[model samples]
Target: MPNVPAERRRVTLQRPGPLLIEGPVEVTSENGTTVSSDRFRVALCTCRRSSIYPWCDTSHRRRAGADDPRRAQPPPT
Candidate 1:
């Protein structure tokens, strides 16, 4: 998985709400700057209000059952 690109990386946002990013990732910006990390499995922010920037800080739980665009919508019954 080391040879794979970060952009190609994908994972599921489970019931617990953590971005389970899988491997060989090198987080970079448009400027080509590398954001170093200790591990390839990273939990990224989705609530858009994390004080920790990219990592989730349990903020999503505060808005449970609401129509959050970030969360996956229920399928049509």
Candidate 2:
């Protein structure tokens, strides 16, 4: 077979939200594992808050009076 470049995808950057891409897409992890989505649009989580690992479940959304576990607090008086 002749050498050819891989297909390029259209990705939309959503601040504080998942990285949206036109699917179906195949994502390969650093450990050599892979995951896929067949939806019209795929949401890849950037904040590591998704229970589905590489996929986004909107867990990054801010909730009322919810304290972020990753934030540093001031010293108590």
Clashes of each: 0, 0
Candidate 1 local lDDT, 14-60, one digit each (tens): 65466768654556645776664567687766665666646667776
TM-score of each: 0.48, 0.69
Which ranges in model 2 have alpha carbons more than 4 Å from their true place?
Answer: 1-5, 63-77
lDDT of 2 by residue, 18-62 (tens): 899998788888898888777888989887888997998998886
Best by TM-score: 2
lDDT of 1: 0.64
- The pairs that clash in candidate 2 are none
Q: Which is the leading candidate under lDDT?
A: 2
In the predicted model 1, the residue pairs found to clash are none
